[model samples]
Target: MRNMLITGGAGFIGSNFCHYWAEKYPQDKVVVLDLLTYAGHRENIQSLENSTSFAFIQGDIGDQALVEKLFTEHQINCVIHFAAESHVDRSILGPDAFLQTNIMGTHTLLKVAKKFWLDAGVANHHFHHVSTDEVYGSLTEDAPAFTESTPFAPNSPYSASKAASDHLVRAYHHTYGLNVTTSNCSNNYGPYQDSEKLIPLIIQNILQGKALPIYGDGKNIRDWLYVEDHCRAIDLILHKGKIGEVYNVGGENEWRNIDIVNLICAKVDAAVVASPELLVRYPHTPCATSGDAKSLITYVKDRPGHDRRYAIDPGKCHAELGYHPVESFESGIVKTIHWLLHNQRETVNQ
Candidate 1:
């Protein structure tokens, strides 16, 4: 059984992955390291705290000494690096944190892994870096989906920092033979996601009757992947991926920003109509008072350097690793809305 060190395990996609891994491989030891940043919450992984195979540590990934200590103590044989300052708007406002965490933090992890796993002659260790598709920049409507060979053209500080980290991972593999693999995925949506993101934000706002803000004309497109599907892809990669190679993971589900908001409104309205108890729980919602959730839509100026479109071609991952996403947007969004409805108290307080 593998002893895995998962960074950013308290955050959105990371927490989901932690649960997925722990449940799927009960014999393996799963250790989570997280800084509990604004987007990271303890409650996300609270259920796994009592599991025999699970452990949680509140810490920074960039702390070399702490990392080394964990490596020695846990006998960590695999590193799934997911920690980062991921919000594009946050990065635009404050880029220093992104650089420090995404670039420097990743470098520190590489150094510690090289010393303990490579220099110390440990065998069968692997490093998997999780990244995003924004590094490929904007794509015109007519442009084909981004392939593995697409050149980097990051337009925002967040994407740029991720791109830098991606290069570092590649350099570590080719230059130092660190036995690394990277997967750059498209937009992910599911339970436990931060409310600041588009999907969760819309859900939360609709529940509270707050404005559903759309950026620009809300025509920007993004390929969406369900969080569990992403975790499954990573599982396949860790087990079957070629070392030193990069794979693109996507759901092949594309939706425009405005369209996603509208869909959520319709779905939430339908839920409220079917279950009147939801009206008691979220009394302020438009649907609670015979008003349509769509009435809350409001358009605002777009953020600077906002990419027009992003889509991933997962052909290589499918052909080589037998990876395919099972959740369609219709079903995935339904699950997400249902989760938020049940967890409204905890989700809104956060």
Candidate 2:
């Protein structure tokens, strides 16, 4: 692969992919372009800053001029388009930013990549668009996972925007014959993820004795994939995937919202007994010795258009791409809980 330009490389999945690619291709030059939105933190890539092959730029991917300049200067042959407005609740509050970043930004990237691919000389080009399964709308309790042929039925503004971007990617490939591959993955949870998400938010609250907020009895189900495993799937698709095809990446680890939170609380409670502060609390209050984080859970109203259940089959990726998650959710969540407990010094929500 030639120069790889990964947009939103500082965000959760994008950042994880950046580190993964940087470590995997030590000699290949990788550049990251991020808008530094609330969800992104440059400090996430602190360890990789010293590598000459990796470069970081604080900018929006929607900037046409800057995008063109990067394509020209870096001779970027691969585009891992990850920049987008991802928060479903936030999108409900404010959709303009989502349309601007998710839809318009993708248009800008496709325009630039098309030019390069059409004029490609002794180089291969690909734009791998990262997306979510929410684009398939809410699945019923007995419904099967979404496949590549699943008709787009986005509900929330976030999924709608992502669907628009996915359409744009497909159009570029069909109309202009630009090499592009798309992946719609399920919910991802792991280390270095923003605290606003489900797992990290619950983990942070339990550590500080704060109320863990659950939406609408917390029965909504989501298939969780380890971020690193998602990164590996993206890598396989980028190299071996056929042009103009869509892939679904998931670990098949499905759990209800409250169930996952309760499991995390039990794990954290057992681990917190080893903590110095919690040991002191146990001596003062005999009942508190239980260290039950589950006591803090409080359910609230659900957001508008909440998808009840989403389970990705990932059979296409597994069979065609030979892509399967290496880390099970059990092992992944254990490691995630421990990382949060160790990094509890930060009161950061970033």
Candidate 3:
């Protein structure tokens, strides 16, 4: 039975991973450390409180003493580091938090892990760094998807900090022979995601009868991966990936921003038609009777350093670690919309 420490376990993808691990590996103990930042909500993984195999700690990963104490107390043999300031817009607005959390916090975790797992002679130890494909920068429509060999060209402060953390993890592996693996994944959309994200924001706007803001001309492309699929890929990599290797995880489903917005509009519109009571509740929404939700679409100024396109080549993950996203964008987006409609409907009602 392995004791696993998962950092940033209250955020979007991180919380989903925590629930996945708790449900899938009953023999293992899962410890979650989250600072409950703006992106992280305790309610995301609060359900884990019912599970005996799961535990939560409110703290920062940069706290060396706290991190080391948990290491010793739990005898943690596995670490899945997900703590980082991940929003590109937020990073553009203020980069200090990204640097402190992504770079310095990662360094502290690496140092403490190296000391605990190596110096203390802990066995069966593994460190997995979760990352993003934005570190490879944008891709032209004709350009091939980002492979593991792609050089780093992070455009935003968020991606830059993540790139630096990636380098630190690599340095530890090379300099100290720490058993570490990294996975760079594409965009993820699923339940419990922050509404600030593109998909969820569109869904929320559709439900609230607010404008669906599209960035720029809305032609920027992104490869979308379902959060569950990303969680599965991480699980596979943490267990089977080779040490000192980086794997790219993607859904291979690239969609333009406008297209996704339109799709969500269409789905939400159809759902309202089927459940007419939804219209009664959200009477102000365009779909109350005849109007289409797409009418709410409003193009706005794009954020600075917004990448034109991002795609990932997960061929290595599939061939080596047997990883492939199971949810298609169409299916995943539907699930996300349904989840938001149910959960956020309460918000609208309130």
The all-Cα superposition gives candidate 3 an RMSD in Å to the true structure of: 1.2
lDDT tens digits by residue: candidate 3, 1-350: 88999999999999999888888988899999999998899899988888888889999999999999999888898899998899999999999999999999999999999999888877579999999999999999999999999999999999999999999999999999899999999999999888888988888888778999998999999999999999999989887889999999999999999999999999999988788777787787788858999999999998898999999988999899888789999998889888887777346654
Ten-residue region with minimum lDDT total, candidate 1? 341-350
Kindly indicate the candidate among 2 and 3 with the higher lDDT. 3
User: 1 or 3, which is superior by TM-score?
Assistant: 1
Considering summed lDDT, which 10 consecutive residues are worst modelled in model 2? Answer: 279-288
Compare the candidates by TM-score and give the number of the best one. Answer: 1
Best by lDDT: 1
Q: What is the full ranking by lDDT, best candidate first? A: 1, 3, 2
Each prediction's TM-score against the native? 0.98, 0.94, 0.97
Off by over 4 Å in 2: 120-123, 277-290, 348-350
Model 1 lDDT per residue over 209-303, tens place:
89999999999999999999999999999999999999999999999999999999999999987897888888888988899999999999999
The CA lDDT of each predicted structure is 0.94, 0.86, 0.91
Identify the runs in model 1 with alpha carbons over 4 angstroms from their true place: 345-350
